[model samples]
Target: MIGNNISFLKGEGYDFCELKEYEYGEDVKNIDWVISAKMQKPYVKVFHAQKELNIKIVSFLNGSTYFGTKKFKQEVITQIASMLGFICVKQGDPFASYIANETCELCTKKSKKIFNVNFMAEQLFNYDVIGKNIDYEFITNDLFKKIHHKSIIFLIGDFFDIEKLDLKLLSKKHEIFAIIVRDKFEENPSELGNVNFNDPSTNQNFEGVLNSNTIKNYVNKVKENDHKLFSHLQDNAIRFVKIYTHEDATKKLIGLLK
Candidate 1:
């Protein structure tokens, strides 16, 4: 069961085993004061090597994910989530998933079962991108209450309108690995004559001629936005990976994991 596999690790090599009465040969510093106070006797912490690890994935799916030049961003999210789930199962760890789009769904699996992993992956793949906008702040705030244990978190999204403070707060509780998926067109639009651009998230329409000046400004804006997000992640010590829609998801994910 999931509860059976739960364990705690401490320090460089100390894995918490249990608490017991202080023995003659036990180190005085190892005493668990709170436990001893409750028991009216001295207790020392014990240690052993931890045997399992837990992994949690928080996926943010939005309408922007549907726009892609090659493979859809939603597909990339599924592939990456599936890969992590398989890795967790192979490591004999419990895997949990919290997917957010217009609404949120939590899949908490305690067993190391392939079925559980595949179910989560399928949910991600089939998620519809009908959300008006991704409320990343709201999602992160909800996650703060839901997640109680220390686990590796995979935060997957295009991050169109994410707040830096929310990410910082989320990272404080768990080891966060950020995956920013993007389409080629998002980074650089084709220099077509005059075109009407629609914002997928807001359903807003913008009509403009794709002249040299317009393209330059658009590219620069995209670069500036990406740089800011990257800098914030780096400053907070969050591991970040960028995946393009056109790239092979398996190869890219493997390389990033390595």
Candidate 2:
């Protein structure tokens, strides 16, 4: 609606409201079939919201996001971002995005436009994550400075390298929700005999043997990293959820909101 007569999707979600008798041409998906059967009449759900939220989705992308056992982490991140943006549009909320890596950052102009939603998703999905890394501390500080007005911000990423995150300052002005997109195999792995692997962040090749002991060590390190990350986020009262690449990102994100 902000630009051309170009059409985009809507009705992805809405705030809950009391149900009423179903009407013709209404979406049957909204019908509470159980309630309708009990009352012996067709009834439909209703949703209402008086306040609009200013929403921002910040994608912390790096080379690690390019891999997934089932569906790539980048794809899951795109799905989550697109769903969140569409929900914002449906609920009449202004939306913006920040797609960043170690070297570059792209911040979109804030608007309640469907084009922005589509464009943001496209950018995230097609983004090249090769030979790149993410600096959580720098990203957090930058966000704190740029996003002035109070808003709801969702940060999505594969938090493999969060040695230290300075989110305390950013959480003061905005309600922060962190979505840690990961692959199941990253945590639980099946050992492949001696093989060569390339470091995604650095693009450096190395030879190593993936044995049970190595897998155990790697998983333990990942667990320790996550423990520290969770502790920091909890200390700041920032709610977070982990979405595996193989899982339904949209459903999980919606559940997090609920």
Best by TM-score: 2
lDDT at 244, model 1 = 90
* TM-score between candidate 1 and the true structure: 0.77
Give TM-scores for every candidate, taking all chains together and pairing residue i with residue i.
0.77, 0.79
Q: Which sections of candidate 1 miss by over 4 Å? A: 1-48, 107-111, 163-165
Residues forming the 10-long window of minimal summed lDDT in candidate 1 = 3-12
How many times do residue backbones clash in model 2? Answer: 0
lDDT of 2 by residue, 3-44 (tens): 211123233336555789998999999999999999999998
Q: List the residue pairs that clash in candidate 2.
A: none
Query: Local distance difference test, per candidate?
Result: 0.78, 0.83
| Best-performing candidate as measured by lDDT | 2
**Residue-level lDDT tens digits of model 1 in 1-258:** 233343454322355677888989778888999999999999988775455666888788877887777888888888888888888887778788888866556865666789988898888888777545677767777877778887778888897654433677778888888888898887888789899978777778899799878888989988877878888889888987898988877777777677
